[model samples]
Target: MEKIVIIGGGFAGLNLVKRLDPEKYRISLVDRNNFHCFPPLFYQIASSGLVSANICFPFRREIKKMKNVSYHMGHVKQIDIAAKKVTTSYETLEYDRLIIAAGSTNNYFGMENLAEETFGIKTVAEAAHTRDEILDRLERGAICHDPERRRRLLTFLVVGGGPSGVEIAGAIGEMKKYILSKEYPELKPDDVTVTLIEAAPQLLGAMKKKSRDRAVKDLESLMVNVRLNTGLKSYENKYVTFADGHKEYYETLIWTAGVKGEPIPGLPPETIGRGNRIIVDEYNRVKGYEDSIMAVGDIALMQCEAYPNGHPQMAQPAIQQARNLAKNLNKGEFRHKFEYLDKGSMATIGKNRAVADLKGFSFSGFFAWLTWLFIHLISILGMRNKLSVMVNWFWNYLFYSTSLRLLLRPTRFPLRKHWGD
Candidate 1:
């Protein structure tokens, strides 16, 4: 049997493995994280709607039933194409065929100073840190008597008007209205401000024109300040300078602005393209490698007719690409090229409002929210995770209060300040 080694146990790698029959090959999957996180609802976790553990599913337990499959937990440093071996932190391994599903990272767009000032919502760790950071600022605001400084600390700026940005802004809006109102009776709902900024002229740039128009209107109705075709030109600490020569101080800055593929060492610079994606041919073969190496998911820049530049680096595209490649790899027939199956995209603004663009149909409001919740719940990894999340949502819906709001504090104000507020 042939040996297959995959790097990055994200949606792409795990889904690919599911499509492959274990008896046909020996497979080893590697990732820096031991658990698989559901990416769609990461905003809920960040906004305190869900706990970190609730969204995480251990990879080993989930994949344990497969006989021929194995798992490794580590960061892959380089690929030695000449020897057909991959060098990771623990050990070096060889494979008859390789899949580079190694994921993406937050892109700063070469603005080093600004990158230091902003945070990206990409990983479970980052998401949790962001949640703690927001709550920490609120605690400080509660005691400070300076009204102007308090307003600044309470003001939240969300950069990048994409789905993550939209969702985060909406969630924060809900937090300001419902969660904050219930928790801090001293602070009025009007004291907390949530702003959404995007360099593009509209939000959800890839969606239909009407959908984008409706999203902006819905967000405004939700009291989320939407600023389009605008962004931070530079930032230092809490002060951000925008392109319009306006500088503002904000305590909480949620950066969902940009992303670039995580750079893999040892691949020639020529193989990399814009956004650091590994340029792959129509068949998803990494450029300059005939059959020994391939890439999928966010790491691969697959060029095709429907997606002349490359398909959207979303979960559905990744899952479809992985399955297509797995089918060809299990057999000797490697003739088919990977094609994306367009499953419509959706975004939720608040409790009962959302926008969805299905293949030929577009829906919004209550039905769209239902679609969003059902799809996300079904996509969650394990049964316990699903049940825990469902219960939390149920309780929140009825009571308008999050179950776990107590600060897991370090107990000393000085120590908390040292951690950087």
Candidate 2:
């Protein structure tokens, strides 16, 4: 059996592993983390609507049924293409076929200071940290004596008008409206501010005009301050300076602005394309390599007539590309070209409010919200996770609140003295 080494256990790599024939190939999957995360619902985790475990599934448990597959928990340090060896943090492995699916990282656009200070929801840990930061600020704000400090502590700013930004902003807005006053009686609804800033002219740039308009309206209705055509120039000492020269004080800055491909080291510089993605052909084969090496998901930028630039870096495109590549590998030949199927785009604002742009038409309001819920619910990996999410959602919908607000902090135990001490 040929050895197949795949990096990343995200949507692309995980799907590809599942599709590949166990008898024909020996598969090894490497990732920094030991579990797969549902990124779309990360905002819910940040907002205390769902916990991290609700969306994350262990890789070992997932691949246990596959006889030919093994999971390695480590980060890929470098890839030696000529020798066909992958050097990870823990071990070095040789492969007959190498697949790169290392997804993406938060793009701070050279703003290093902002990157360090701001919270990002790109990963499970980041989402948990964001939730903790928000709650911490709220607790501090409740007892703060200084008026300005208290105001800043209560103010939350989300940069980026895309789906992640919109969803998180809306979630925070809903929290401020429905949960804040009840949970923290010291802080009124008016004390908290949820602001969403978009550099673009409108929110949800990929969606239709109607959907974008609906999103803005819904956000505004939820008491979120939507700021369009506003770009962040700098962030210093809890103050964000806009491109327009105006500055605003914010305690928390959640950056959902952009994501660049998390390309592995050792690849030729020329192969790296826009957004740091590895340029590939229609068959998802990496540039300069014939068939032994390939890249899929957000890391691969395959240009075509339909997508002249490249397919949108989304879950659907990643899964589709992975499936296509898996089929070709299983056949022992590259018979099919990867073509992206643009399913649709959807963003949920708050309860009974969402926007969905489907194939034939676009819609907003309660039905769109339901469609969003149903689609995400079914797309989740594990049955137990799905049930847990469903239960959490049902409870939240019925009570207009969630009880998963406990701040999960690391327990710091005192160091035990040695026998001599």
Candidate 3:
């Protein structure tokens, strides 16, 4: 049995484990967090639509059934490619083969100030923090005397036009229209504002033109301010300066702007490409390291004729690459070149509104929403998580209420400032 060490317990690494034969490979999985977080539904956590536990799964419990698989919880500091050693926070791991599927992190694009001030919803903790900030602002605004301050507290800004940004903007809009007004009667519905800023001319740039237009219209119908041909210049505490030299005031700035690959150290500089992704060959093997190393998920950049750049940094590509690599490893030789099966994409814009581009057929509205719900539900990891999400969806649909809106603030002045201060 080969000693296979997999770094990062994200979608790619975990799927690789499932596809590999334990009898043929002794696996070691390492990640900073002991649990795997479902990224697709992370917006739900930030919006208070679902709790973190509903989407997070513990790795220890998952690997308990696999006899040859071991779990290590730590961050990889460096990978010694020459020695076949991976130096982590805990110990030096030696492996016959190493798989790098460490995934991605928020790309602040060199704006350190904006990165510090803005809230991101990438992890469970980050999502929870954003939710806390939103609820805290609402609570403070309810009794605030200054109208300007109150308005600032109620304003929400999402700084991207991708799926996460669209979903977040829509969720916040629906929350204001449905949840906030009912829960905090002192706060008027008009006081809350949800604005989505996109650097691109259209939202969901990868989708078809009709689908993008449908998403914009749906967001507008839900009372979300969709700003296109606009970009962020700077964020100074409570003020947002746009690239067009316009300024807007908001308390919460959710940074869903972009993401870059989270590459680990030790690989040659040439193996890395734009967006920090590890450049791989047709077989998903790291460039110049065909036998000893491989990469998958958002971190692996395999540029082909169809995608001269690389496949979209998405779950489908990551999982497919992992499976393909596992199959090749099982055959004891690289047998096939990895090909992406483009399985379409969808984005939900509040309750009965969504846009889907499925194999060139674009559609929107209630049917699209249902399709989105079904696909996401089936894509979730565990049975319990799927059930919990379904129950939450039904509950929100029937009553327009979210029970997970607890302000779990860990520090004093979690919002960085107080109302009328």
Best by the lDDT measure = 2
Let me know the TM-score candidate 1 reaches against the reference structure.
Answer: 0.95
lDDT of 2 by residue, 1-421 (tens): 9999999999999999999999999999999898999999999999999999999999999989888999998888899989999998879999999999999999988897876899989999899999998888888888988877788779999999999999999999998888877788888788888999999999999999999999999999989999999999989999999999998898899999999999589999988999999999999998888678899999999988888878988999999999999999999999998878899999999899999999989999999999999999998989999999999999999997678988877555675433111
* Candidate 1: clashing residue pairs, number: 0
> lDDT for each of the candidates?
0.83, 0.92, 0.90
lDDT tens readout by residue for model 1, 1-421: 8888999888899987787778888898988888888887888877888998888888899789987888887788788888998888777888988988987888877786655676557988777777877787778788878888788889899999889999989888887877776787768777778899999998998888888888888888767899998977877778878989999887778899888888888899989987899998867788898587888998888777777767787888788878888888777668887768788889988788789999998888888998888898888988999999989988887887886664554345444432230
Spell out the clash pairs found in candidate 3: none
Q: In model 1, what is the error at residue 67, expressed in angstroms? A: 1.7
By summed lDDT, which 10 consecutive residues of candidate 1 come out lowest? 412-421
| Cα displacement (Å) at residue 135, model 2 | 0.7
195-214: candidate 3 lDDT, tens digit per residue? 99999899999899999999
Best by TM-score: 2
Order of models, best lDDT first: 2, 3, 1
The TM-score of candidate 3 is 0.96
Where does candidate 2 clash, by residue pair? none
